[model samples]
Target: MTYDPTNTPAWKRLLTIETMFKEGNERDRLAREAAATAASFPRVIARYLTDAGKALGDKALAVTVTETGPRDDEGRSAFTVGNCTVCPAATTEFWETAIYGGYESDVRLTVTEAAQGAEQVVRRWAEAHATRCRELPVEG
Candidate 1:
């Protein structure tokens, strides 16, 4: 599938923008930061969904975030964001890459992670989407 950050939920978009501005060279640190940021996006979406209730699935929104590298198996860490409601979820496997005598590493996540990640992401999206959906003024 294809990964499009632009179409991500608004709150998620803010999270990604923050992550991009963050400064870090360590793969784990960056992944942790990214995961934390991603964790928040879903919460925001869920909050809105809870408020909106019924209007959800009709305009269901999903978001995805992916961080690639920092590898060699044996308990390596990966980071990513996934949302299908707004755009198609990705479908590539995450890969861990090691480089420069272990001085540098990258976390690569597959599109499939979107599937695994969606469950959590969607719940969060629903909550927030619900809230926002309720607030939308009647278009009639």
Candidate 2:
């Protein structure tokens, strides 16, 4: 005998189709948002890098800006310059910051709590360390 979907209730079939449509729409919306975010990333990162430079002051040119991206859920973004990576600390206030990587050192700075402008201070420190760091990343 041929397969028969009629064995299933009409309302159940309708519900299944409706669920599929809702899932598809949600996926499409997420894809669109991701695409828009990716497209705008370069400009956004450039602005952050520019801000990092201003924070760097006379040492601005010493560090080479590299990769950058957002951590939206954490309410922060990060960028790597030279051998170091810097990002805002994940806290309730989002006032703290963290920096990782250094010259042949597994250096990390994590602040559980901080006053305002802590991120700026971390950025400045990260930039300075990046300038002097000569350690290259190891390839897998």
Candidate 3:
């Protein structure tokens, strides 16, 4: 369906939305590019973490990935990656700050709520599974 934003009374709203649409479209393009760049992070981090674990003789903390959310009101979606649960490695706020650093605009705090949730779930997992620590082979 096509949008009928033309009949709206507020000229500033229309202009602002237009500007936002233009900027958001650009940001979306950049996000896709960033995702392409980000494709290497998991493999790299996993390798590093595994190597570190092996070096320190620490048991590898297995992280499982799953889809977080496509929670959208206006057809926008956000994704997260975590240990089976949806905890983002780096958050929306981090990305926004990284992207729009020089501007004085308000930074939208999407991660505050999601990070809180992730933290709660992580806490629960640690508490519930505290007795089950996997031991690695130790070298003398």
Which candidate should be chosen as best, given TM-score against the real structure? 2
lDDT of 1: 0.40
With candidate 3 superimposed using the best TM-score fit, by how many Å does residue 18's alpha carbon deviate from the native? 18
Show how many residue pairs clash in every candidate, following the order shown: 44, 1, 0
RMSD values, in order shown? 22.2, 12.0, 14.4
lDDT of 2 by residue, 84-112 (tens): 32322211113223433222235553332
Give the per-residue lDDT digits (tens) of candidate 3, residues 21-113: 999999999889666645534321111122334456544433332223322212233333333111223222222231233124354444434
How does candidate 1 fare on TM-score? Answer: 0.22
Model 2 misplacement above 4 A? 1-8, 44-67, 74-78, 82-140
* lDDT of every predicted structure (CA atoms): 0.40, 0.42, 0.40
Best to worst by lDDT, what's the order? 2, 1, 3
> Which digits, one per residue and each the tens of the lDDT, describe model 1 over residues 50-120?
23224445433333333343222235344333333433433322222221112122444343333244334
